[model samples]
Target: MYQKITVQTKTEVKPQTTAHLAQTMTLLNMGNGEVEEEIQKNLAENPALELDEINRCAMCGSEIAFGVLCKNCMNNQLKQDSQYLTFVSTREFPVSEEAADNEDYFEDGTVDRQTLPEYVLRQVGMELDDREKMVAASILTQLDDDGFVDVDILELASYHHIPISSVERVKGLIQHADPVGVGSKDAREALLVQVDELKRSKDIPEWTEKVISDHFHALLKKQFSEIAQQCEITINQVEKIANFITENLNPYPARSNWGDVRNPQENEMLQLGAPDIILSFFENNPQKPIMIEVFQPANSNLTLNASYHAALKTVDKETKMKMREDLEKASLFIKCLQQRTNTILRMAQVLVEIQEKYIREGDRYLKPITRAEIAKKLSVHESTISRAVSSKTIQLPNRKVYPLSVFFDRSLQIRTEIKEIVEKEKEPLNDQEIVTKLEKKGMHIARRTVAKYRDMEGILPAYQRKEKVKTK
Candidate 1:
C-alpha cells in the first residue's frame, strides 16, 4: 500500500529536465537519518557511487588540514568580528569496525523526537492554509497536560477576529488527531469525540454516546441500574456498555502513550542523542569567534568510483549509456548532499548572529524572530528555511541541546516572562491579573494567551495555586 501510494505520487509529478534541482530540494527536507539511509541505498544500488573514507573539505574537496574544512575554506568563511565559525564535523562516523555498532551516527537519528503538540502539528500543517495555520498553532500551543485546550474557544475566535465556526472547524480537526480526542474541552467531550471517531471504523454500541452524554455522572459513579432504567435498557446492557468504555476508551487523551500527566515531572520523554550542530566559542572564549559544528553523519566525503568511470570508457555503447546514467545519479546525489550541508551552514550562520545574545545569555533575552525573517536574510523561501530547521537539534556552549526551531520561537520570551511572574507572585494571579502584570512590563498579550502560556509551562490556575498555598 505504501509503495503504491509513493508510486502514484511520483507519477503525478511532471518530468523535469533539471534533475539536480528536484533532487536537491527533496534532500534538503530530509533529516540526517533519512539522508544517511539514502546515501547507503545509493552506494548499494549504484556501482558508480562510492563512499570515500577520508575526511575532506565539503566545499573544495581538498584534504582537510585540521578540522572538517581546509584552511582556505575556513579563512573565506571567517569575518572580522569573528561572531561565528561554523563548519561540518565528521566525529559522528565510526572510527573502527567494533565501534560502528554503537557510534553516535546511529543514535543521532532519534534527535528528531517530537513533543505531543509538535507531533500533531506535523500531521495537520500541510492540510491547513496560511490563516488556518495560525488558528491551528494557537489551538496546539494552548493544550493542557490532559491534551485539552486550556483557553476559551470563543475567546480565541474573538482574539483572532475570525468567526467562531472557523475556530470550531480547526478545533474539530485537532480533536481527531492521534490521541483521538485532544483539543476537547473536558474528559466527557474527549470521550464523545473518541466514540464518534470509533463509530466510523469499529462496531461501537449505539447507546454509547447516549450513556456518555446524558448520564456521564451516573456512568462515572457506576449507577448502571439507574442508567438502564432511564434509557429503557436492561442493567446487563448498561454493564456491556460500561465494559466497552472501560476497554476501548481513555478519558484523558494524553494519558495513553503520552507521559504521565498526573505527575507533570514524570512525563515520558524520548532520550536525545548527539546534536546535529554544536554552538561554541572559538578557543572557548566569549570574545572570540562563535564556532558552530554541523555534524556530517557519514563523517566523510562522497566521491565517484574512479574504477567504474574507467570501466565505462571501455564498455559497449548500450552498457556505457546505462553506466553513465548511474554515474549521473551518483554525481547528483553528492552535489545534493553538499547543497544540503551548505544550506544548513548558511542558516546556522544567520541564526547564531541573530540569536547571539539568546545563546550567550538565556531564554529571557530571546528576541522575537520568525522563519520568514531568516528566509529573507538568506534570500530563500520561508518553506526552505522551515525544512532546514525541522527536526534538527543544536547543542549550546552550556551543554543544553535544543531543537533548531527554538531559534525562531517568537513566544519563548513571553513564556519565560509568564513563568517568572508566576514564580515570584505574592499571591495567585488570575489570567486577567497576569495580563495586567504583563502589560505593566510592556508585554501586552490577551488574557486567554496568558492562560495558554501558563498551561504550557505546567503552572496551575490561581485557585489551584491558592489551594496549594493553604495546604502548605
Candidate 2:
C-alpha cells in the first residue's frame, strides 16, 4: 500500500534587531568585565544620553559624597530604627602562646605574629655551622600552624637535594629546639615526642607509655574493653590511660610560640563602572527601588564649549562628519553600559525572588534549581541567564549574600526533607536506612543513590563512625 499526504501550517518567526543580536552575542561570548567595558564604550559614543549624578539625598536635599548615604539623614534613619541592626560574622585566629609575653620588642611592646619566622631565626643565632643552620632553617620553614613539619622526611630531603638520613637528623635537631614539638613530622610523632619530654621530668606508667606509642589506634577507636584485655587491666584503668594520652597530646604540635602568621587569600571582586539606575520589584513604589549606580568620570558634566562647536562648524564637511561619528561612538558606549547594568540588575532581582528561601536560610535550605528554569522564566536563552549570574553577588535582607551562580546547581535526588530525615536518625544511618526512609515517604530511591548523596555531603561510612567505649 502507498499513501501520499501533505500538511501545511503557518508560523511567524520574529526577526531580531541588530542591537538585540549584538547584545545577545556579547553576553554569550564575553566575561562580566568585558561586557561592562563594551557598555561603557557605547555610552561614550551616544551624545544624547547623559549619566545623572546624585550629589544630594533624594529624600532630603543634603549634599553627600563617598557613599549614597547623606550623613545626617542616615544617622536619623538608624536612630529611628535602632532595633533593626546589621551584624557581620567574621573568622579570627586564636592568639598564640608567644603573644602572651609582655616584653617590648616594638612600639606596642608586642611583636606581630607575622614577624615570628625572622624572630625564631634571630633567636637561634649563628651558634652552629652555616650548613647545619641551613638544614635546621629549611625544617623550620616547612613547619605547619602547629609548629610541626607536616611534610614527609623523604620529600623534604628530595626538595632540598639532601640525603633522607641528613634531613631526619636536621629535623630531630630542630624538634628539640625552642618549641619542644617543632619539626616533628605528623600528629602522632609530635604527641609521642611531647610525651617523651614530659616523661623525662616525671615517671609515666608503662600502660600509659604503651597506650601512646603502640595502642594509639585503640585510644582513637575508644576501644576500652580491648585495651583493658591487652594491658591486663580493668576498663577504669584503660579509661585512665586514655585520659593520660589525651592530656599529653599536642593537638597543634606544629604551631610554635614564634609570631609567624599568614593571611588568607582574597576571593576575586567584580566591578562594573557606569551611571546608576535602580531596579524595583514593586511597580507602585519608586522611592525604595533597588539602587544601581554606574560610576562615571568626575568631570562627566563638562561639555564642548560654544566656541569649540563654532570652530567645528568652520571645519570641512568630511572632517566634521568624522568628528561627529567619533562623538556618537563615545555616546553609544555609555548607552550600552547603562543597558548592561539594567539587564544584570533585572536578572538579579528575578533570581533573588526565586531563591528567597535559600537567601533567608543557606546551603541547607538550597532548592535544586537550574539555569534553564530561570532563563525560561525570564524569557531569555539559558546562556543569557548564565552570563547574568557570572561574577555577580546579591545582597539579601538578612545581610546574607552569595554569588548568583551558587543558586544554579545540578538537581539532587536527596531533597532537604530527605536530608533532614537522614540527619535526625537516632543511630548512624547507613545508605540502606536512608533508602528505607525515602521509600516510607513514597520516594523510591536506591541505597546506592542514598550513598551517593551521603558521599556528596562528605559523610563517611558506618564503620568509621563506630566508636569504642574503651581504650586498651
Candidate 3:
C-alpha cells in the first residue's frame, strides 16, 4: 500500500524497557508499606515526582500529617477510654503515645498475631503423650491459619507407621482443646463441635442437635416444614432450633469478634502494619451493605513537579529534552501506581459481591472462588490478579486483618462445606456417601478425594463416628 517510500518518515513509539520493567515489578509485589517506602525513595532520587502536602490523617482520615492521626481524634479517644487518661495527664496528647509503650502493644492489645499453629503449639506444650506429641505437632503445623486441619490422618499414620487409631485419638484431642473448634475438619464440623461443647449446659434446644445433625440444608434454607417433618417436630419447634443455631453457631471460628471489640487506641493496631483496606458493617443499616474503605499509603499522592513541566518550555534544547524524559518517567511511575490500585479495587469489589453471604454470616458461607475464575470474570490476566493480591492484608468489619489472597482459596472453602455435610449426615456418611452428597451440592470430586479431605480435616470416617454415637 505504501508505494511512495522515498519521502515517508515514520516515528515509532518505543517503551522505556528498564524503567517499565522495574516499575511493573514494584507495583505488582508491594503492599501499602512497601509502596510508601518506594514512594519516599523515588521522591529522593527522581527530581520529577514530588509529594503533595496532604493535610490529612492517614488513619482517622481527618486532617494532619500523613504519618499520624489528627489532634481531634486523639482528644476524642482520650474522652472515651479512661485508661489513656493517666498517660495523657503526664504529657500533652501527642499524635500517638511515646515510643516507650510501643512494645506493650500487640494486635488488639491482647494477643500476639501468631498463626493458629504457633498459638496451638505454645498452648499444648508437654501435655500430650510422647508419641502423641509428634503426631499432634505434625497435625497442628499442617493446619491452615484458619485452624481447619489440612493433613490426612491416614497418610500421617502410614508415614509414621502407627495405627490409624493413634492418629485419630490425637486428632480428637486437638479438636476438643481450647479454641474449641480450631481443629475441625471444616466450618460445618467446627459449628457442630462448638455446639457439642455448649450443649453441656443443657440450655440448648433438645431438637436443635437433631436439626443440625440431620437437616442442616433444610435449616440453612429456612425449610422449617421439611426439617420439622423429618425430625417429627412442629414448625414452631424447628424455629426454636433455628434460633439456637443462629445464636450459637460461628462459621469462621479462627478470628476474634472484631464486632463489639474495643481495642484501645494504639492498642487497636494490627501487629504487622495498618490494613490496606477496611470493611465496616452496619448492623443498624436497613440495606445491610458492607462499607469498604480503601486506605492508600501517604506516598500514593505523587504528582509531577509543576516547575519541571513548566521548565521544558523555557530551557535550552538539550536540557529541555532531559526534562521531558524525566517528566515521562514520573508520569509512568504514577500510572503504574494508579493501575495497581484500580486492579486491586475492582478485584476486591467483585470478591465482596460474590462473598457477601460470608461477610454477613461468617466463613461458613464462603463459596469456592478461585483466582483463575476471578481473573476470567474481570477480563484480566491471572498474573495481574495474583500481583494485585500479593502481600496485601484486608481489615474486616470487626477490624480483623486477613490476606487479600484468601478469596482465591477454593479448596479450604470446599473442605469447610464437606466437613459440615459429614457431621450433619443422619447416619454418618462414609467417604463414598460423602462424595455423593458433595456432588449434589455442586462439588464434584473423587470418593478418594472426599476421604482425603475428611481425613485431613481430622474427621473420623462414617463407621467410626457411628461407633462413637452408639457408645454415647
Q: What's the count of clashing pairs in each model shown?
A: 0, 42, 1
- CA lDDT, candidate 2, residue 236: 93
Per-residue lDDT tens digits for candidate 2, residues 1-472, read: 0001011111232465555544443443333434545545544654433334534333244545633334554465456643221111111212234433424222211232232234455555454455555555555543433554454667556645667777676666565555566667666677777777888687665577676667777777788898888878888988876677666555344332333333411321111111121222222333332322222223222222234345566789997887676555444443343344444544555555565555445555566666667666666655455555543444344333344445664324355545677567666666777778778866776665566567546566655544421221
lDDT (tens digit, per residue) of candidate 1 on 1-472: 0000010101222333456755665577666777777778888999998777565655545565444444654676564444466566665532334324434325444533456667787777887776676677666654555677654678767756778888888888888888899989898999999999988898997698999999998998799999999999999989999999989998878656653223332211223445678888777888777787777666336778989999986889999999999998887787677767877878887888888899888998888887778878777756567668766778888877676777876678999999999899999999999899889989998776787678767899999999999999
Which of the two, 1 or 2, has more TM-score? 1
Q: TM-score: which candidate is best?
A: 1
lDDT of 3 by residue, 119-179 (tens): 5656665566666666776666445435675557787687556789988877776766667
Ranking by TM-score: 1, 3, 2
Q: Whose lDDT is higher: candidate 1's or candidate 2's?
A: 1
Residue 374 accuracy (lDDT) in model 1: 80
Off by over 4 Å in 2: 1-20, 23-66, 69-312, 362-365, 398-400, 410-422, 439-449, 467-472
TM-score of each: 0.65, 0.41, 0.49
Q: State the C-alpha lDDT per candidate.
A: 0.73, 0.48, 0.62
Worst 10 residues of 2 by lDDT: 1-10
